[model samples]
Target: MVPFSLTAAHGSIHASTKQVGCQPLASKGLNHTEQQAGEFRSSRRLVLLLGIASASSLQRPASATPYKEAENIQYGLSNGNIRPCPGGYNPNCVSTASLNDLYSPVWRSSLTSIATSAQVLDSAVMQSSDKAQIVIKRSMPNAEYLEYEVPGLFGRDFMEFLIKADKGAGGAGEENSEGAIVLYRSIAGNVKYLYPFQTAISDFGAQRKRLEAIRQTLGWRKLGCDLKECFE
Candidate 1:
């Protein structure tokens, strides 16, 4: 028979092995809890930060409202748009029918449709083969001009942004501000111009000066007419 002391020692060794195994399992459980807590705290902090950011944004001041464009005239070509008349007209009513009819050829050649409210005129026929300079004069007094060209965008219409500024001499004094409008045009076969809503002659003059400054800074050739009469 085995000695009594030897049996007791064997039991002790078995108990010690079991204790060692259980100690690691308990330590693993503790580590898992700590990891989960850290993740939960991080998520909570993220949610709190997002909520604070949203609240701050809501407290900011609102932007100024934009100016509204004029309504379309009742009579003209294809949708009551102002086109060059068959014959020129009296200087008093330069925007009227007779004057538009006179410039019909130019209007017919370049303009496809004119959006009065948007202050944009789209070129109907694509004149890609020949390089041509397009000129547009509208009856709308406050109508301004911007030109851009893009292919297959805006339903294949040449992109044009209508911009306006005061045509008065006062615009010459202050040319840098948010009130200044910008027009963009691409070199593709698209031809478009932007006209801002009812602006004074002074505003257009100031906008023109700012554009000239940008052109000078970028080393680009000056484009388009800066006639005070046009802006007025």
Candidate 2:
């Protein structure tokens, strides 16, 4: 008795050796043993070529995909007064205060003065802000947190301002008032896959420049050393 069965196989074999000057054994006139040796060499060459192609593909950079603004999700600030690194530490996050030495200090001013400056910033941001949509406000006993969204290439970027009116260590009114800001670039969907660490660093530089311009426009003084020293 004979048994019959049907099965389907699916696979792909990329024969790139031919493109690299490798010749087929069947087309050459040779003895059986010579032909076998040639075939083995050809197989080895094909395997090597396939391996190279795979490595190159993996090393290739990722590309940014189209972004849909409607799909973005914005998170609200945490409860309580403003603290150092309100939303915690993130690689894509930058803040005015030093958080675990990860963030750099921004211009420090009085809460009242900063509040006045915020009005100007709000107006400027409202008029020329990139992809900004939502704004959330929170007031605590000694501080305030203002969070907003800015349009990003792939997803929405978060911008936050923290204002503190507590007294300084010396109990002096001069240092009681302080303000800070932070920017968080959100990488979502295809953007994360396409943009590498280098691209993210570039984005951070550009955003810092924009923020610096705003700070200058408000006539805010830099509290720490040079901005360049803040970067890691």
Candidate 3:
């Protein structure tokens, strides 16, 4: 028979091993719970991030209207004699006058004289004599509107000039005073994809320079001039 002490020691060793194995299983269960908690935290963080993005999008302001849609719409002329182009953008047009500044009143002259001078200036600077044509001339009690067409490679560019007498500053009332407000817009022709480049090449600096030369020729002082690019 085996010794009693030896048998009892063997039993104790077996029990200790069983307890050690059972401890591992308990640890595995705790680890599984921790992994589940970690997954839950990640999911919650994702939800928060999505919620923030949605809120930010909702809080953003609406975009401004496009120029084409708003170009025909006119605004009341202010003392500055300039107004923002509808929608604040025009891809086909550029101007050397701004709506931001109060332009100095210039001495008023006859519309016929101004138009003649403009035509002469345009003919002198244009690439071809036949390319420029005066299309419209209208006169109001206070303002004169003149539009010119310049043929381009793809289409015809249009220029509109507005010359208005300052309030009570010209004509019979103020014969000696010759100050007037002048505004002009050079619009590109209707050729898709090439309109911007055409406008830039045909107008931009070239048109502005011609206008300045005309202003100097007419003995008008520069008030405030600006160049605005068309929004693509």
Give the per-residue lDDT of model 2 (tens digit) for 1-232.
Answer: 0111111100122333333235654566566788667557777755665665555546456443222221333344445422333222123444544355335455554234435545655665565475565467665544455666776544556666665543443353333434433222222211232354323222454345555565555555556544653332
Who is ahead in TM-score, 1 or 2?
A: 2
RMSD value for candidate 1: 22.1
On residues 3-45, what C-alpha lDDT tens digit does candidate 1 reach at each position?
4444454565556545544575466565766656755665565
Residue-wise C-alpha lDDT for candidate 3, range 8-94, written one tens digit per residue: 545655565455445654565657666567556655655565565555546456554342443344433345344433213334444
Clashing pairs in 2: 130-151, 131-151
Candidate models: Cα lDDT each:
0.31, 0.46, 0.48
> Model 3 scores what on Cα lDDT?
0.48
Instruction: Count backbone clashes in candidate 3.
Output: 6
| Number of the top TM-score candidate | 2
Please state the error at residue 195 of candidate 1 in Å.
39
Q: Score candidate 2 by lDDT.
A: 0.46
Candidate 2 stretches greater than 4 Å from native: 1-91, 97-102, 110-114, 127-131, 169-191, 194-204, 225-232
